[model samples]
Target: MSSTLIPPSCGRAIAVRAGGLVEVVDVEGSQVGDLWAIDVADPRRWLSTSHTRDTLEQLFPRVGQSFVDQRYQPILELVADTSPGLHDMLFPACNPALYAREGSPQHPNCADNFVAAAGQAGVTLPAVPDPVNLFQNSAPDADGRIAVHAAITRPGDRVRLRALRDITLVLTACAVDFWPTNGERCTSLRLDQLDGDGN
Candidate 1:
């Protein structure tokens, strides 16, 4: 296992061998990285933010805490961790409709990206649900509506995912024009296998 840096504006299919570690770094500050993790043996059983958050709140992951799936399987171990304190669990992937709303007159959407990727991989699905927003922030307002705010993440911040089962992880750095207050642009990400000392 070697460390690979995925530059901004590109997508990659990362495989996390059972018990292997996957760490996503936000190389540029305040950018959002959309992530989805699927069971390799059964892609249907992917990572769920609702389930993950529920578990995290209950267990309170500290340094070296393990992220467990709904079935109580350890998906990723948190060898290295950092802020925003929590991740956004409610932002769904941008669909065709969203594209019509936010995309430029000729550009594609996030759903298209997922569909293209899935098609290339030969995995089929009815609909793509909300994915985990790794570095974005959505805070509930006084009236209880969620508001998209500037990212709480800074450069070099990361979340580590360890495989609970054989899994396929799908990720796309958000291409949305309106994001992170400053602006939304491609992010440079690096994925590295944990060293023996766990740095």
Candidate 2:
């Protein structure tokens, strides 16, 4: 297996063939990573959180469940999770506007990092898609109030996913330090492109 280190507050895009696997490693504890997948056959097609939610009728990802693309086609599968199993598909990737609204401006954000990294990978899209927030701990309460909290993932925790199609995977080590997200401290992540039968 080959690994890619996603430095703190940075992002990277990698291409993986169908049936290939990628392991998202939380190199440090209490960190969040925003993840996206783009179909190589059609760059315009992407992993759609909304579509996946509609298909699965669930908000959080589950092991053995497949995530679909914009067209409702399975593009990725959550094969394993070693964390608290709190991955979220309810929020958008942190952006510049989000930081500015929170009294901070020009902060390193996952949205920008994703765009830059995707560009370097020669993949462009009409708009930024909502990412699956890995290791995120925010969930709706009894009254339906969603309060974001810090991730509880321990160091070396990881989620392993498999590609159902030729695609480019984008991952950003979340940069949200102002709120409880990321435990108010940013950290690094790792992407391990594993060979066959990694399970």
Candidate 3:
């Protein structure tokens, strides 16, 4: 397997064929990563977290479930998870406006990261879609309040996913530093392209 390192607050885009296995690794742990997938054959069909949640009838997908696209087509399937099994799909990717409101204008956020990465890959996004917040620790409480917390993933924790179709996968190491998110410290991540059928 070959590994690609994503420095703190940075992003990357990789091409994956159908049935390809990609593993996302938290190199230092407690760092959140925003993830998105766009169809290579049809860039219009991008991974929709809301669609996946609706199709799975759950807040987040299980290991065997697949994340669907806006058209309700499966995009990527969760193959394995070595983390604490904590992820969030209800939140939108962080953007400049959000950071600006937090008094941190021009901060590098996941939304911008996706745009730049996808642009470099020659795929134009229709919009900044909600991402699968990998390693994020946020969920609605009984009172319907979604509170963000630090990720519980330890060093080297990872989640492996399989592409159901040709895709352009984008990922970003979260950049939040003033909040409990990412343990108030930005960190790096890694993406490993493993050979074979990921069995």
Residue by residue across 109-136, what tens digits does model 1's lDDT show?
A: 4566666665566666666756766667
User: In model 3, how large is the Cα lDDT of residue 176?
Assistant: 90
Judged by whole-model lDDT over C-alpha atoms, candidate 1 comes out at 0.65
- Cα deviation at 153, candidate 1, in Å, is 2.3
Model 3 agreement with the true structure over 40-134: per-residue lDDT tens digits: 99998989998898898999899999999989999999999999999999999899999999988989998999899899999897698899999
- Give candidate 1 misplaced runs (Cα > 4 Å): 53-74, 77-79, 103-105, 118-122, 195-199
List TM-score per model, in order: 0.79, 0.98, 0.98
In model 1, the number of clashes is: 2
Q: Which residue runs of candidate 2 sit more than 4 Å off their true CA positions?
A: none
Q: Residues 99-179, candidate 2, lDDT per residue (tens digit)?
A: 999878889999999999999999988888999999999889999998999999999999999999999999999999878
Which residue pairs of candidate 3 clash?
A: none
What ranking of all candidate models by lDDT puts the best one first?
2, 3, 1
Candidate 3's displacement at residue 14, Å, is 0.2
| Candidate whose lDDT is highest | 2
* Model 2: lowest-lDDT 10 consecutive positions: 56-65
